[model samples]
Target: MLATLLGLDHLVIAVRDLDAAAAEWRALGFTVSPRGLHSPHIGSANHTMMFGEDYLELLGVVAPQPHNEALRAFLSAREGLERAAFTTTDAAAGVAALRARGLAATGPVDFSRPVPLPDGGGAEARFTVFHFPREEAPAGLRVFACQHHTRDAVWVPTLQSHPNGVTRILSALVATEDPAGAAAHLARLIEGTARRDGAFHRVATGPGRADIAFAPRAAIAALARCAEEALPLEGGAGMVLPTRKPRPPALASGTAIIFEEAA
Candidate 1:
């Protein structure tokens, strides 16, 4: 049987300075988690901000290794929402299904990191992940799948509270030269469909899941009145979060985060 495509797992922001990025997130009213170091092969580390079912991660390469060459390359070009991961229960099967569909989805790679707790104890958060080739992704986007083996270690109760009152992601945006084509391609990559509303190509993931949209990078740049190259793919790497109260817009790594009041 073909592996089913689950909803979004988390969004990753590739940063040059791990601690500074985490600090910025904290200052933005998020309750950030302590840093976690990945295996040497991966050569990366991260800090996370949990939001109930999903979360956001600030990823940085701490040690150079073969496995993290792509991540290093991403950091060289820019820093922002570098990758987006979808949830999957069976990563091995997910790869096979992608291959059967003629997509070159890579391994169910296993990795883990130590999660520190407030009670002077720690746990390990393990995961099996697979990747879709960059060619299959739309412009300025990288997509992957992740299967969490230890969910509690990640969604710890103490880290769930955010002073900003943000509860969940409402939508994610992608900018491409050809949004119509990109939207269709994105839907196809994630085993979904897309519908066009004006310049936006919207893909509804599911109930309680963030909606994804693709638009023209040039148009977004024009509307923002900034140089096209000023932002990553014309500010395509943006997300909407519903907060309990209004907060001033936050900007980091050229990505502007606009928080809105909860409905």
Candidate 2:
């Protein structure tokens, strides 16, 4: 198992139309960041909804490039929750720890994107990402560790206030055929303990304290109000958001997001 301490970073939602997706999120009462273009080499763009330390990223492919072929394919197949990233202070150490556990990691690759600041200026947000081998990652899930070089540039207080009354992310729900097996794998990756709760297995990482639950296929389908086949095999099926009062689950680009009353 990896030894690095990981915390929830952000969730990615892939969309076909960036403008429409942003507008939809706004209508749902979220404050979204201005569109940010990835480095010219990456061929992608994103708009983010900031919520304290963790946020939601709406990703779209603006240009086709070999480097972003995987993202392009994900968009072509369907649009919804595509990836979940965790935070690490030292990405190199995190990769080393994963490698020590016999898990293949690609790199602590450094990248940056220009983000439009609320004050009408541009600031560069830098990041280093450590990726796991597709085969070793959780089934139907794309997970990675991210180390931010410029935190202030990404999480501005002015952009975090949302009209939907959401304060923070609580959990990401994953539907899988084998909840126990999936939970075990995620526990190892996050270096956390997994416990069974009925048909769901919950793994809680430190600091962020957000739960990642692996639920039985039927249970998740019921929660999402959709057919089981409509959900991703092992991908994020829904998200739990903390709100002042209970709000019904909302569907965005095929992903179900539940808003629960904050404790």
Candidate 3:
């Protein structure tokens, strides 16, 4: 059986300073886990936050060796939630399918990370990640994914407490320059039902769903125009995620997850 495409695994933000960002998330209530450094085969060094089975990672550059041009470019863009990632069961097959759809991708490459086990020991799990190559003006918000080896561990977060009300990831907003083309490309790459409505495309999967929103990066300025509220951060981007009940911020990372009580 082909590895099933699971829901979102995690989201990563490429920040300017790992220490500062991790500190911000901790003050907000998340038990930001220990930070880790990844090498060549793995990629950049990262500080992580766990939220049940899902997580949010803050990645930054330490050295420029083995240099990844893409990662370097993202860092140059200066601070913000950088990448949105989905989880899959099989990396190899997933990449193949994506290619068949005409989207250029990389990896299914062997990816591994060590997690601190509850028993005080650490265990390493292997996985794969497939990513869109360039962060072009047209594909800045391009989609990517991860597939992990399931050996059963005591890390991650409890699904019940996920902050996003994400009943199954209704969809995500991907702002890209070529909304129409990106939507069409995604429609073919993801083996799911999709419908386009102007600049937004809704993608539906068996147990998960997501919306890809296309817009130029310049549009972030509009978001800044919103009224400012007293958020946890002294001065940073913030928003509330409404849920069925009032709960503390589910998890914290560079981009903290906010929860709201259902109205």
Candidate 4:
């Protein structure tokens, strides 16, 4: 079969403080990768927590540039689940598919970051990405598709093990004015289907991938109370929640997280 939308690839949290964010996730028991620097054109840096089939990225703008203009604005408003990327085997094909469906998907933009290897070496983790129209996605949230060219440089086994035993992102909870509309838009972007259940609209990415639920703020805020804590953009942890700074839907801004444990 030709390339298809794989599933939820990773969740992105934009933080004003990358080092502090990295330290926080590490304290939460995740083995985050060393900071990866993007090309000058992008002017961003990140650290990632690798999982079996997905990961979570903490991104920050280290320099001002045209490419990260939207991201900078996101950080200004709040720092929390800003974007979610879908995995694709072929980025060009994925963009084509989205266009075929009448969505104005853009890019097969390629970039790379240097990764410091455990064995005192380094490798470049390269990627190609296509973005769904910003106006089409929920306000303050970005959705896109990604294709990885250097899996080994990324999905490093050592980085996949977390002390908390959290395995992967289970779901994302988004609070929006129109749950069904938001959920349907995201489902279409990921090549999934959405179903409405009362105040929530749920989008399941695929088998063994993250699910997204769109709901009203009150409905999502109720779930947040059960969590140990929530950060606007830093709400990713599993099994054992963070030792400090927790989430509630309001704190998570537009999206809250639901994690899984299999340590």
TM for every model, in the order presented, reads 0.93, 0.93, 0.69, 0.85
lDDT of 3: 0.52
lDDT of 2 by residue, 39-140 (tens): 877788999998877889999998898767877888788888877888878889988888887888878788889988778888999988887766655646
Put down candidate 1 lDDT per residue, 1-263, tens digits, no spaces: 12455687788888999888888888888999999999878899999989977888889998999878878888888888777788888999899988988999988899999999989999999999999986776666788888999999999999988998998877677777677887777788877878987777887665577777777766545544556566676324667788997876566655556587798
| Residues 40-116 of candidate 3: C-alpha lDDT, one tens digit per residue | 65566776655444565678777675435556776674565565666777677777876775767787666566666
**In terms of TM-score, which candidate is stronger, 1 or 4?**
1
lDDT of 4: 0.72
For candidate 4, the per-residue lDDT at 71 reads 91
A best-first ranking of the candidates according to their TM-score comes to 2, 1, 4, 3
Which scores greater on lDDT, model 1 or model 3? Answer: 1
- Which ten contiguous residues of candidate 4 have the minimum total lDDT? 234-243
The sequence of per-residue lDDT tens digits that candidate 4 reaches over residues 8-113 is 8888888888898888778656788999999888899999989889888889999999889989987787777778788888999878887887888889899999
Kindly report which residue stretches of model 4 are placed more than 4 angstroms away from their true locations once superposed.
1-3, 226-263
After superposition, candidate 2 runs with Cα above 4 Å error: 227-230
lDDT of each: 0.79, 0.82, 0.52, 0.72
